[model samples]
Every structure is written in C-alpha cells, then in structure tokens.
Target chain A: MHPLAAVRGVPRRTWLRWRFAYLVLLPTLILFTYLRVFPTAWAFVMSFFEWGLVKPAERFVGFDNYTTLLSDKNFTTALLNTTIFAFATTIFSVILAIALAAVLARVVRGRTGGLLELLYFAPVLVPMVPVTLGWREIFNYNHGVLNAFLGIFGITRVPWLSDPNMALVAVIILSVWKQVGYNMIILIVGMRAIPRVYEEAAAVDGASAWQRFRHVTMPLLAPVTLFVIVITTIASYNVFTQVYVLASDVQGAPGRLVPVIVYDLFQNGFRFFKMGYASAEAVYLFLIILVLTLIQFRFLRGSRA
Target chain B: MNLRRRGMSRVGYWILVAVLALGGIAMIFPIFWLFSVSFRPASEINTVPPNLLPVHWTLNNFTVVFQRAPMLSYLWNSFVFATISTIFIVLTSSTAGYIFAKFKFPGNNAIFMLVLATAIVPFEIYMVPLFLQMNALHLVNNPIGLFLPFLVLSYGIFFMRQNTMTSVPDEILDAARIDGMSETGVMIRMVPRLLAPAVSALAILAFIQAWTAFIWPLLILNDPKYFPMELGLSQFANTGSSNFGVTSAAAVIALLPSIIAFLLLRRRIVEGITITGLQG
Candidate 1:
C-alpha cells in the first residue's frame, strides 16, 4: 500500500478523502452549467452571428454586430445616457451615504442606529414598482409635490419628468433616494469599524472634527469606499427598472439614454420580432458593460495595489 | 469618556439623530404616499388638487385590485419562486460551504477564486444566453426557468464557506467524525446548528434577490399565468387605466410581502450586510 494510503479510516487516498465534497459540489456545478455556463456560451456563439427570434437561418456575421454597434446613433446615445446615469448616481449616492454615515456615526446614540437603519431599509424592501409609481405621482407636473415644493419659493414647475433634459436627472434622484440608505448602512459599519483609539489619538493631538475625518476616518474606510463605488456604478449601469418606469420609451423625445436605447432595441428585437437586431443590440450592451466593468475593476485594483 | 468632549459628543449625537430622522422620512415618504394613495377613492387620484390624505378611505381599492387582475396568482408565483430559490440557495451553499471550510481538498482555492470571479461579471450578459438556453430546453415561461439558474449561487457558496470557516471549530467536526459520523452526517447533523445565523442571513438576502428579480423573470416568463407581482404591477400601471387607486393598491399588495419580510428579518438583514461589508 502507498504510504499515503495507510490511514485507518479517514482516507489518505486524497480523492476518496472527500466524497462528501464532490456530493456537495455536484448540484452547484450542474446548476451553474445549466444556468450560467450554457447561456453564456450560447450568447457568445450568438454574438458572432446574425440571428433573431424568427429568422429561418442564422447568417454567420463575424464582428459585424460589434462594428455596427459602434456606428449606430441610438447605441451611441444609449451609451452616453448609461454613462451619465451611472456616474451621477454613483457620485450622489456615495456622497450622501458617506455624509449620512458620518452623521450617524457621530450623533446618533443608543437606539438611533436601529431607528435610522430601519427607516432607510424600508425603501429597499418596498417593491420597485410602487416606488416608481410614487415618484410618478410626486413628479406629476401640475399637482406633484416636488413642483409644489418649488412653487413655495415662487419657482416655476421644473417639468420633472416631462422634459427629456430634466428626465434623466429626475431618474437619477429617484435612484439615489432609493439607494442612499443601503450605502449609509454599509458606510456606517465601515465608519464604526475604525476604532475609537484613532479618534482619541487625533483628539489628543488637537485634531479638529474635519481634520480627524479627513485623516483618520476616510483613510481607514478605503475598502468599504471601493465596495460602495463599484457596486453603485455597476448597479447604475444596469439602471433599467427606474428608467423604464419613469421614461417609458427609449426615444426620449429628440434623444434617448443608453438603457432606453437598449430597451428600444429589445422591443424591436423581441417585441417587434426583430431578433437579429435585438441580439446585436444585446451583444452591444454586453460589450459596453464588459468594457466598463473591466475599466472599473482595473482602476479599483490599480488604486488598491 | 473624556469629560471635556462629553457635552460636545452629546450635542453632536442629537444633531445627527435629527438629520438622519429627516433623511429617513425623505427616503420612505414615497412609500408612505403610496400607502395613502392606495387607500383613497378612484376619484381622489389625479384630482384637480391632490389630497395628501384620502378624502374617503376605503378597502375597495384592495378588493378591486384582487378583482382587476390575477393579483393573487402573481403573488403566489413570486412567493413560490422566491421560496424555492432561497431554499435551494441555502441548502446547496451550506453544504458547499461546509466542505470548503472543513475539508482540505486540492483545487479548493482555485474553485473559490473561480466562483468569486463571476461576481464581477454584470449578469446582463448572461441574461439573453440564459433565455436562449431555457428556450432550447423548452423551459421558457416555466417557473423552473426562474428557480433553476438562480439555484447555483457562487456568492452563497462563498458566504457559507466564509461563515463556516470562521464559526465552526475543527475540533467539533473532528469529534463528530470520530464518533462514527459520516462526512455527510457531520455536515447535516453538526454544521447546520453552528451555521444557523449565517443560513438565516443568506436566506434573507436570497429572498430579497429572488423577490426583486425583475429582468430575468421578465425575459423568461412571457405567460401572464407565471407573471410575478413586479411584472404584473408594471402591466397594471401601463394599462392606461384611470383607476390609479387600484393600481396603487396592487402595487402595495405586490410590495407587502417583501416589506413584511424585511421588517421581520431586519436584524438578520442588517447583520448580514454589516458582516459581509466588514469582512470584504
């Protein structure tokens, strides 16, 4: 017998040592193959061809979809819109979260943590549809509370959702409002994990609140900050539900945002039975997201390193 | 503890509380508005002058919501899908988590790295391919379409591994094995009790993810019969009906399960996020 195989019961036979491990991993592998790998492979294959829902035969069109996407007007616009939405949401949500987290860390005592967390957490649990519908009501030009609030200061109705120019901004605000609480919770935990010793040390050196925050708190929160930024950005890029609900269609009057364009493509591809075009559009979106995600991961990795 | 900063700290804490309270209200105001609107009469919605409070409060909207569409059916669909997916996630992840934590196996690190790598890939790319795969298998518009793909959660496995490795001591596991417990027996009998909290936390996350899942279900489930509440809500909202009250009511119904679940499981949810955030 091999020296390694001399174990009495617990197998020194390395492979036999973990039948349970294989058993455990079996379902996960099967599920991933069916759900993730199979689809991902199929999509990759489909990307290389011109095919749709109804086409009798798929024409092999290598790189055509990729090249065409680069030139498509709607694709460009959607790209821009997606960028704007993601950038705006990420900046505002992160700032708001950091601000709220700082305050929550400093001011709230006792049950304050629980209370603030609960309140912020409410929006997360509330279904997106209701939240979007509520925003629609609030952004209703004539009777909307937002306009009503602005009217109090003798300001004119801002056409919150009506004007395409302001529509994107309105959508961004809704996204931030829905998400800020989540970021706050995460940020607060980050802030809390920074020990009291740092604050005490800073105070001993006569460092003011702003000084301590800038030097002590912010630096220690590097990981959480990166997490918040990456998640928010990725999520913003995938900002479909809010946009679909708020803006309704892709052609936002004279112009459309990237996701709206994607949705339009989807509508054309699937709804209108233009499968070939929709696949092209999906592939286009895939490439864009892929590039942006790569950039984000690279930047984050580079910064961290 | 410093006497000099005591008063300042107290004042600062109160100020922060007030600000956070206001912010929290701002965050939840839309939800409150949704609730109030749902209770109002049909005529009250889109009124000449909006009523913050309903003129004539009634449950008629709720009644009509059930009557107007297959609201109950949609609710059941969402509940079933969320439940099945969550259960599968918890069970598979826990087992995988146990093996990764307790057993020293070759390629463990490599396997974990592979699983974690998928986390960064935006799921949008996989969406269409997944649909096509389902179509190929004739699973389109099927409930299994929602549950099957979602079952293999890399994050769940990672989470379970992280939790078990940290929480389950090797001694207890070794003792279980010495006591004639099979490896599977050790996992089933011993590991679960130790990993209950992590399991619940994962369950909450899985539930929310599955419940709020929009795009996947939207793509796969074209049949109205399998329409989850979120999609159903959108369909109702877009029907161009003047009954905003009922629409709002249906929205509320759709949202209630998650809201209630979150409220019930807020502690677990908060702990899960905080723990994951800290560890990461």
Candidate 2:
C-alpha cells in the first residue's frame, strides 16, 4: 500500500477503501456482465446474421432479418394482435384499478376493506400457469361455469377459445382479472402518500367532495396514474404465458388466430430453431419498450415541474 | 341541506360497498372453483347443469393426479430451486446495495446506473443468445443452468439500494469500522441485522419469483426429473388424458405453496409490493 501510494500520488487509505468496495461488488458485477449484459449485446449482433442451430456457420445477412420481419405475415399479425391486446388491457385495467382504488380509499379503514384487498391481491401472488389452467375450464364451451351462468339468462354457449376474436378477448379478460388488483394497490399507496392537509384545506375553503377530488386529488395522482399506465402497457405487451396456455395448442398452432409477439418469438427461436429471425423480433420488442420508457421519462420530468 | 346530503351520501356509500363486495367475489370465485372442481367426482364435473358447489365431494382426482405424475418430486424441485436462488439473490443484493449506498468510490453512480438499466429490459429479448451461451457452456439440460440467469437480479439490487439509503445509518458503520471490524465483517454481521425488514421483504419477492418462473425453466430443462411444479403441471394438462378434474387437482397442487406463503406472510408481501411497486 505504501509503494502504491508513492507510485501515483494516491493515498493508501483511498486505495484500501476502493479495494474493499470493488471486492464486495465483484460477484454481482461479474454475474450481471456475463449473464445479462453480454447476452443482450450478443442478441443485437445475432440479429444481423442468419443463425440456425443445425447450420455449420452463421451467414451474415445485414438488415435481411429485419426486412423479412416487415414482410412476414405471422410477424405482422402478431404485432397487430399484441398491440390490440396491450392497449385494451392497459386501458381497461388502469381505469378499473383507479375506480376500485378510489372506492377502497373511502372504506379502507375497515376490516372488510382489508379482506377485500387480500382477496383481490391473491391472484397476483398465484403463478400464471395455474391461473390459466383454472381459466381454461371456466372458458370451456360446454362444461364451463361462465357459459352455464350465461345459460341462466338463456344465452347460448360462447366458443371462447375456438373463435379467434373471442379467444383474444378471453386472454384479455384473464389478464385484466389478474392485473387489476396490482394496479389498484399501487394507486392506493400513491393516494395514501398524498398529504392530508391539502385536502383539509380545500374542504375548509368550501370545496365539495367531487370538486376536491377532481381538482386536488386528481392532479396529485397524475404521476402514479401515468406510472400505472406505462407499467401495465409494458407488461401487457409481453403477454405470453396466458396466451401460450389458454389460446394456443400443443404445437403452438392457432398462434396465427391469436398471434402474439412473444409466442411468435418462442416458436421461431425454440420450436423452429430460427435464432436470427427470432433475435430480430426480439430487437423489435426491445425498441418498442425503449420508446415507451423514454416517453415515460419525458412525461415524468414534465409532471415534476 | 346538510341532512339531505348526508342521507344521499350514505346511500352512495352503501352502493359502493355492494359493488366492491361483488368484485371481491368475482376475484376469488376462480380459486373457489378450482378447489370445488378438484374435489368433485368426475361424473359431476361435466354434468349438464354445472353445480355451483359439488354435490358429492371425492378425493379421486387427487389420487389420480398423484398416480399419473411424480408431483411430489416436482414440488421438491421447485422448493429447492426457490430457496437456493433466493439465498443467492439476497446475499448479492445486500452486499452490493450496501456498497452502493455507503461507499463513495469512483464510477459508483455509473455502475449503479448500468445495473438499473438492465431492470427494464425484458428477459425475452435476450433469451435466444442466452440459450446459445448456456449450450456452449454445456449448462443446458443441467440444473445449474436454471440458476445461472437468475443469479443476479437488477431489480433486487435497485430495491435494496433504495432501502439501504433510507434505512441504514452511516455513523453506526463508521463506529464498527473504527472498532477494528473489517468491512466484510461489518457487512456480514451488522448490516443485515439493521436491514432485516428490507431483507425479508426482498427474500419473499425473490422466493416467489424463483418459485413461479416458467419461461427460462421451460427452455433449459427437458428432463422430467428437473421439472418444477409449474412446468410439470402444464405438461400434465397438455399431454395427459385432458381430464379436467385431474388437471384441476394438479393446478391446485401447484398453487398451494404460494397461497400458503401469501397467507402466512401477507403483511410482509403487501408491504414489499407497496414499497417496491414490484408485483409478485
């Protein structure tokens, strides 16, 4: 340490401190760089080549994979279907969550409210595989509880998983049911974080409950609401498990009927071994999310001011 | 005017309560249905008019599920994977978080930002190359492969760093250092004790994630012996006789650990989500 201190005008104390810090951080940094950072960079590189599992060598095809994606019917269908699913789920889930959180905020001091919160959050805790398995039965055409309940009103059995549009709707319904409570809880926390004095002051100034909420509560909630929207949208765009289990078949057929981005990527990469094309699709997904995140940052900065 | 307004507001409040109760019922009905179907006799499961509750409850489905698959093995695998991975995550996250929060070193913010950047990128994007890398390393089809991708979570580091900043005091650490305690010793003994609540919360989150992870496991493991509960259940549902009752039983088995965990540690789980905005 004394020799090091003499070498470059560095003190031994600072050197020792730096050494300890680095030693502590070494394991995490090494794992992240190897497992996460390297692979991400490799994926972007792999996207420019025609890589396959059984091929002897990777053939360089610059921009070819991306161009193929633009023309691929399956890719286009998946992109469109995923877009619809993402927008619908985000809008419905965010609105319902806010409404539920608002009502719960009114009654959250009671035991009933606590129980309700627990019940709602239970789905979010359970794994997606089981949730989708349970829903498959509920969405069954003949023996399902949903159709049976509908039959009470003399409505016919709906082919929930058979028809393409209804199948997508079914996926959307399952997602919203699973996701609403999470957003509601987050929004509730955000609402509780708001200082009460401002609301009390507004009340003293003769503001009605509705007026106070619309003016004071709503503006303060903007940031959290935006956060919920962005997070929900991103999560919805990555929807695969529910669709994989509920809508598609064993070989992932009818993925066409209910085409989604991740399903397409899974089929391409894992099933067909078309690694390069799949990497291109993944890059597209990454770009989409990147844009969304950047937009979130922009809005977040604006809201702060 | 005040009395009339109060009466109207009371009516509105009751209406909202009723709506919330109905929504609560909707939320929990699927779980109730899963249990009911799993316990129902096969003959009663597909009856012309589906009974809301089973007219005759039976354990036949559970027996059939166990007979058809090695469910006990699947549960054991899931438990081990979740437990071990959680330990790694907590150890790495706490040490790294402590360093970032307390130590003022060169490239600290830059390194922390690099870690934070990885948190937002979905795993699906890089999984192809990751799969190849695992194959090259001869880790594919091995249990070690399952733990490789999850060894270091960017989210865990970020969460712990934020918690450490707010919770841990610097004076105590300085005192410990001045008392001739090594940095590693201070970290191993004192830091974890001070951050026990955050550590527990992080542990729960990590445990739940490792327990429920599907996609990566599906890609790495083709051997049934290594199949976690979720993968085992999905395979059974798809390849088995398509018996809804048996499948429901299998699904119930898969969901039990998490449900039990949530029931016991609900407050910590809720507090974790509230603080971290991390959905389990």
What are the per-residue Cα lDDT tens digits for candidate 2 across A126-210?
Answer: 8989889899899999889999889989999999988888999999999999999899999888888888787778777888777
Backbone clashes (count) for model 1: 4
> Please, what is the whole-model Cα lDDT of each candidate in the order they appear?
0.75, 0.86
Docking class of 1: medium
Give the number of the best model, judged by TM-score.
2
Native-to-model Cα distance after best TM-score fit, residue B209 in candidate 2, in Å? 1.1
Instruction: Write one digit per residue (lDDT tens) for candidate 1, span A226-259.
Output: 7788778777776777776776533332123324
The number of the candidate with the highest DockQ is 2
- Report the TM-score for the A-chain of model 1: 0.85
* DockQ of candidate 2 relative to the true structure: 0.62
